[model samples]
Every structure is written in structure tokens, then in C-alpha cells.
Target: MASNGSDPHGPDRPVVGLTTYGERAAYGVWDHDTVLLPSTYPDIVFAAGGIPVLLPPRPQAAAAVDRIDALVLSGGPDIDPQRYGADRHPLTGAARAERDAAEIAMLQRALEREIPVLGVCRGLQMLNVALGGTLVQHLPDAVGHNGHNPTPGKFATTMVDLVPGGRVATAVGTTVAVQCHHHQALDRLADGLVVTARAGDGTVEAVELDERPFVVGVQWHPEQDATDIRLMAALLAATRT
Candidate 1:
């Protein structure tokens, strides 16, 4: 096992890399572009027994995978429609081109290396799009309601049922209530990936590539729930194998 220098859990504790958002912000008299993420992400990773490394969107960010044992594609803005051969939707947020490129590259490298990966919200959509899948663009248009994202800046609670005997089920059980805040979802699932969970409204909520050690994507934000570390814990556990 690779030693995580200075990690309190000793050298065997896995190192987990998380993707962050690149956007304009103001901090301490500085108002400019910055790379940042909600503390919840790192907090959950730490609670899961992994050292968190925040990866900014950059040309060489994917290379960081070589130093980490697992990867977490954190939630962010909508992906560029062109990446999946579609026109932009009016409701779809503008694409973060650099973030899209960086995360896709990292995901590719992680999958090739067969490292554990967890995708949240936009991360889930990215997993699908990166692997030849398509998104619904505007989820409300397809689901007939904005229940998935009923408010801005706040996560809504929703119920999802996992497929029996699936990896997701094993980690979080067959039925679970999750925090959701997404306006897009998987439309055409990619090859080698299977739908492992869905919302009561029939919207896809989770997916996984069973062939890999651990490649799970959840439309909800598990990080937001300080109590449930099962998903992240599962990713950390996969790093051991």
C-alpha cells in the first residue's frame, strides 16, 4: 500500500482526489476567478477515512490521478451539449469548458487504471456523457415537475430505490432517501454502465459500471448528508482491492 505521508490513519489510508469548481468569486478583498469547492466534499471524504485532494480544472489536472487511490467527480454546472452531440437547452446552464475537459480526462484515466470513482449530481451526468451516454438537458421537461430541483441553493429530499443485489444496494441499501439538486439526468445510458437506482418519478438517480472495482454515480448529493458516509466509504473500501 502507498503511504500517505503525515496521514493520522497511518500510511495505509487511501488518498482520494476530488474535482472542484473553477469560477469567479470574491474572497478577502480579492474578486477574481478562483478554484473552489464546498467544504462538505472534503469533509465527507475525511469522514470516509481518505485524505482529500482537491483537483482544479486545468490542462494537466488529470495527471494527479497517478498520486491518488480514488477519485470523486464533484457536482458542478451543466456539461457542454456539444460534447454529446446535442444543442444547448434554454434552461441548461452555460458550460464550463475547462472543467468538462479536465474531469473527462481524469475520469478516463481513472477508469483505465481501474481506480474507485464516485460521481455526484453533475458528476453523475458527466460519467454518463463521458462514456457515450446522453442527458435529458432539462429534467423538468421530461419528468413534468421540478421536484428534483425545487429550489435554488438548497437540496431537496427525494426517495430512490436501488436495484436488488447491485453494488449501490450493497452500499446504501435497496431504498434510501437522498438530497437532490439537479436539473439534468441521464437519457441514454452508455455501454458497460447499468442503472442501479431511480427516483419515484422514474428519473435516473444512480448508475454504476459493474465491471470496474467501484464506479458509482449518484444524482443526489451524499456529501450534503453528514450522517451518511456509506457511498464515500464504499469508494474508500474499493481502493484497498
Candidate 2:
């Protein structure tokens, strides 16, 4: 059955556009053209009382934002270093030009429309780059430890302190236990973004737009925690108003 991508419960429950990976994905002996996202994304959105729609990473897909109330640029591949006018770091991961172009286009639309957006990990990095920010590229080199992402393919714990009365502070309070798994971080924050939280070692853990109510990004992977959905809840609540 082909889905028109509409949800019956979408009226009261604002629709959120979630970006996905456009790559060859294999699962359960199946292999084909696919756009896939971690279930944690949609699952948290639903738990926060919003309808989640998987958005394929295509520039044309940016038009679909017209039908949704908010956007969430899910975490994935690294952004092209050239996007930020920097040479590649020795440890920089492979760039995904297609995904980068698609999300940046859609993100510009969402911000112009004043739609709520929550970016996580790579999503956060891309957001920064799109708005003229730079990245650290390699965190362990920048910070002297890999605690932010102790394991290559697993979640690690970190304590983040939120700015007083900031968007993240108001939603999830002053301090939080966050799940993180990344080796890149925001170096020079983009214009219009205010740093709202930081890890113990001064890594930028969270940010919110200086002028927008719901545009926020977090370095940590909140969805993987399962206990804290405040960020998702905040975005959902913003759509209601």
C-alpha cells in the first residue's frame, strides 16, 4: 500500500518532518533503494504527541515543509568541510554532499517560515555550518579525551549545564544527563544562535536561536536516552501554539 504520507491524527498533533539517510541500506535480507532513519527519532516525536514523517534527503523534498508544523534534522553523516570554508581535518569523516545540500535547503526554509527545528549531533553541526559556523572536526584532539564519545559505536554519558532561563533550561532544567556519541563539535557558533549549554569540558552541548522560540540544537543524542524527551516535547509544544 502506498502512503500519501498523510496522517489521520495530524490535525491536533502537529506534523514534524524528519530527515533520513538516502543510501543503500540492508536489513533482514532486504536490499534496495531506501531512505532510513533510526526509530528513536519518530518514536520520541510520537511520545511527545507529534506525528512524525520521514523526509527523504532531496532538495525537492524541502517543499514538503509547507505541510508540516516543524522539522527535525536527524543525526547522520558528516558535512562537507568546504561548506564552512575549511580544509579537511586529518580525522574528518567522509562527507555526504547530497544530504548536506538537502537538509541545508530545507533548514533554510524552516527557519524562514519560523518553523520549530531540533537538530541532534551531525544535524547540529550542519546547522552551524549552514549559518557560517565552523567545526572542531576531531573532538579528542580538541578536548584531550574521548569521553564525549568513549566508544566508536556506542553512547556515552556527559553532564551538560544549561543557561539560566534559556530554551533548553526552561524545557529540561539547568542540568541533564545526556547521551552522546560524536567526534565533531561546534567551533565558532553561527550568527543568530546562542549557546545555551555546555559540557563539563566546555564543549558546546546545546544551542537555541536568539530570536526564535523553538529553534534548538543539541550535541547529545537525547532520543537514545529514552528518559528525557524534553527537547522533543518543547518542539511539539511550540507547534501547538
Candidate 3:
């Protein structure tokens, strides 16, 4: 899909569509209301030089995926285990069906249109499940540790070693200290994607398309710190070409 002629981004700057989580959120005096995403996401995109647009849980948006230059699958609630033909683990959290439907559709359409994509945290799991892969529902049972999301609502620093000559290595470096908070991970890789990085515990940390422009997914939250900016910047760079 060619760039929208009436769009403001024009040819100089590409508009990056970042998927947002829709849930009851509270702020200031407002008790609760539906919100798009955590401000950190769009902030990082802006700092990376892309015009960030918050894509809420509207299934219609998925059909226009080709109109954007790139797509950022944001982190959120656990994907339904049924998505990958598995029963839910006892520790699996509540699933977000609306978000699941919208994001999966957008991911598929974005891939079909060759749009650059960056999947973070739960986003990584979504990418895998969308491509007919399964997830380690209760990671601690398989990885033997909860370091991925040590705290319920806090970030943990994890040392991730990148696969040599992979896209992640080319974007960040051979190894990186990442900010992460998740309790699940990939168990089986998809057909067209390859593992690009891993944690010390052998958890799959990152993956990239074998032949695409800049489709990549990381189990960590890169938007949480400055050190991971290069990864986001790499996605922005891919939009121009």
C-alpha cells in the first residue's frame, strides 16, 4: 500500500501505528475510563523520530494496516491459550479477547503488506501465537525461575545475549541489559521466523523475520529505558526505505 496522499507524515517522516491496550484505566480525579496505551510507548516512538498514532481496540483499524509505515504491537494481558490450541495453565491470567482479535488481525495484515513491526513483551507472544506457535503458559514451570517478571508490576533488568549476526545484534549489540516484566515466553518458534536472542536461562528473548525488512520481537520491554532506544530507532529507520 502506498503512503496515504492526504496523510500529514508525507514522505519525510513515516507515521508509525502503535497498538494500544483497551481497558478501564483511572487517572487524576477520573475514576475509570477506556484508555489507549501507556504513555511510555508513544513517547519512545516520538523520541525515535516516528509520528506515533495510538491504535485502540477497534477491529476496523486492522484493515488499514497497510496505510501506516510501521506497526508496534504493545505489551498487555495474556493471550488466550485457545489461540494456539492449548488448554489454559492454572497460572495463566485473564485473557483479553478484544485486544487479541484486533492485534492478531493487524499483525497478519501488516505482515502481508510488508510493514515494519516491533513486538515487545506480550507482543512477542502475540506474534508467535498469530503464526501458529505455542507459548509456555506458565514460564516458571518451564524456565524454573520468575526473573522475567519478578514483581507483579515492576520492571526487572535481564541480561540478554543476542544471536551472532542477527538483526537484534545489528540493532542493539551482541548483548544488552533489558527492562522486562512478563511471566510467559515462547515455547515453539514459528515457521518463517528465527530466534535472534535468548536469556541466560535459555528463554527465547528475541526473534526476526528471516527475509523481511525489520519485523522483530523481543520478550523484554525496550520502551522502558534509554539503552533500548536503538531497537526502536532501527524500526523507524526501516520505514523510510
lDDT of 2 by residue, 80-198 (tens): 89999999987888887888999999999998888889999988888898899999989999899999878878899899999999988998889988889998999999999899999
TM-score of each: 0.96, 0.93, 0.93
Q: What RMSD does model 3 have?
A: 3.0
Clash pairs for candidate 3: none
After the best TM-score superposition of candidate 2, give how far the Cα of residue 16 lies from its true spot, in angstroms. 0.7
Between candidates 1 and 3, the TM-score winner: 1
- Name model 1 segments beyond 4 Å from true: 1-8
Worst 10 residues of 1 by lDDT: 1-10
Predicted structure with the largest TM-score when compared to the true one:
1
Candidate 2: deviation at residue 110, Å?
Answer: 0.3
Candidate 3 weakest ten by summed lDDT? 1-10
Candidate 3: which stretches are off by over 4 Å? 1-11
> Best-fitting candidate, measured by lDDT?
1
Give me candidate 2's TM-score against the actual structure. 0.93
Worst 10 residues of 2 by lDDT: 1-10
**Residue 107 of candidate 1: its Cα lDDT?**
97
